[model samples]
Target: MTVILVTGGNRGIGLAIVQAVGTRVADATVLVGCRSTANAEEPIKELKKLGVPAKLKALEITITDDASIRAAVKVVEENHGKLDVLINNAAAVTLPKSTDLTDVRESWARTLDCVATSQVLVTKAFLPLLRKAEWGRVVMNSSARGSIGRNIALELPPSPHWLYNCSKAALNLATIDFRNAEVRDIPDERDHITFWTVSPGHCKTGFNNFRGVKDPAEGAEVIARLLESKRGEISSATFWEFEEGKFQQVPW
Candidate 1:
């Protein structure tokens, strides 16, 4: 069976991704990465009630804690031997409450740690297991607000969370760096593990106070589509989102 691990899979868009992959991917086992296993109990039960065929298990992980990350690697390594897919869905941003330099600095540091730095660390920790799999895939959950191309074009209105946008942009660059490093000198692309960054759009989750335009399930569709596609069908180190009834590549 394919072994998949989704960070923050207990709620919001992460839960939706778990549901989508569980129902769509044949012979799959989804490890829901939660800070505490107890947090996942209700969600797992609800998913089972919905008749999702894939096996679902709660995994203990705290992305910011190095010890927790190490322990998580050990657990997955001991149980699964290899990880076929990894979805980096857990992230946070701190909106500054004041215009003071200290407050802004604190927000930037914390947000970058949660959204970009910690994600890279988690990926690094799990990479050995990823390499052992037949076809490893890594998906970074990013946002269109992170897109420098879009910002340059003035495609969207200015967002107040500048630090959050910068952090995600760092994530996007890191995705490309991972792909370049993994695929270097690899003649056949099939043998190389693929990396992708996806924008889930403005989903109505607690993260945004439910003010977003789309549902979390609708936002997760693009990620599900990317995972289901054949290795060659989608390029690595690219950004994508499902928009207006079709999948579209988001600008980097």
Candidate 2:
């Protein structure tokens, strides 16, 4: 059976994705990772109630903590044996807004640690298991605010989110870098992985403290579509927009 592991899957976009995937693809079993193992239990039950195969995963992963990262990877590897899909959806923002580079140094670091560093640590920990899969799929949950093009055009809204933006931009680059290293380095082009830096747009999630204009269910549906899309592999790394029942890859 196809297996998927999703981080921060208790509520918001994460939980929605689990339900959408379960409803759309009946065969796949989704492992929902939560900070507190206890909190994850009910959600798993809810998924089961919805007739979706789901499991609760106990993983308190601070992107900055190496030991926790290793432990979570071990749990998945030992328990599931093969992780076909990994969704880097666990991220957070700190108190003070970092609208520019001149923001508090420590706050910036913390934001980057949770938002960007976590992605790198996750990829490093699960690369071996992903490579073992017949077809590996990784989705890096990003935002439109991270686009350099948007910044250049003064399109991104002004917020005191310095490290958050930096971290996402860094994550985008890391996504591309990872694809290049993992796919291009392999002698056989067919032995490759599909990695994407997709913007969830303005979604109503805790990420924006539910102040977003878009609905969480709609946002999760976009990610679900991507996972169940006809194309197995992606062509470029960019700001991807999901609307009107399609994914439009845009310039980064």
Candidate 3:
């Protein structure tokens, strides 16, 4: 069974990712990571209704907390021994429309903690389990907004998305940095781990108050596709965006 863990799996694209994996990969064990397992009750039932062969396990993980992060790592280590895939999908989106610099600063700090810093902590805690697997895979659910070139190409006027966009950009760089470090200090085994940053498109989810253009299921396709990819078929540290029904390389 493929032991896979997806953070923020309680709703939106994260929940969709759980279903997608259940649909596509048989015998997959999915650890549905959430901040609160009690809040995940309904979603867990829904995923079970999908009848995917994967086993859904609830993992309590508050990404912003160190103790929570370590506890999550312990659960997986004790039960699964190793993790085949790790999807850093938990991100808090705070829409700061305020023109005041103080408000912007506050929102920026909060969003960055959840979206960027927490990712580093979570990945650090789980790297041991990831390394135990013969071939591990790490994915960061990034955004096209993270790319300045894309923003210019789309002719979008700069707004209050500075904090959110910068956070994602930091995540993209983290993906690249982690991959390069792993490759440089690669183990003797040929089954090396890989990393990827994927933009799930502007999905109609809570992140945008359900005002986005794409559907959540559609947003989940790229992550599901990447999970199903064969080893060596993907380029580590490459940033991708699912555009025009296909995965396109995005400029950093």
lDDT of each: 0.94, 0.74, 0.85
* CA deviation > 4 Å runs, candidate 3: 95-100, 152-158, 187-191
Greater lDDT among 2 and 3 belongs to 3
Per-structure clash totals for the candidates: 0, 4, 0
Error of 1 at 32 (Å): 0.6
- The residue-by-residue lDDT of candidate 1 on 1-252, one tens digit each, is 999999999999999999999999999999999999999999999999999999999999999999999999999999999999999999988887699999989989999999999999999999999989999999999999999999999997878888989999999999999999877756777678899999999999989999999999999999999988986799999999998798999999
Per-residue CA lDDT of model 2 for 99-150, tens digit only, reads: 4655566677788888888888888788888888887778888877788888
By summed lDDT, the worst window of 10 consecutive residues in model 2 runs over: 54-63
**TM-score of each model, paired residue for residue:** 0.97, 0.89, 0.93
After superposing candidate 2 on the true structure, give the runs of residues whose Cα lies further than 4 Å from its correct spot.
53-62, 97-103, 230-233, 236-238, 244-246
Arrange candidates by TM-score, highest first: which order?
1, 3, 2
Q: Pick the candidate with the highest TM-score.
A: 1
lDDT of 3 by residue, 1-252 (tens): 889898999898998888888778768899999998986788888777866678888999999999999999999999999998899999996656686988777788889998888998888889989989978889999888787677778755465677888899888889888987887887653656788998998888888789888888888889888877888887888887777877778887
Of the two candidates 1 and 3, the one with more favorable lDDT, higher being better, is: 1
Q: Give the C-alpha lDDT of model 1.
A: 0.94
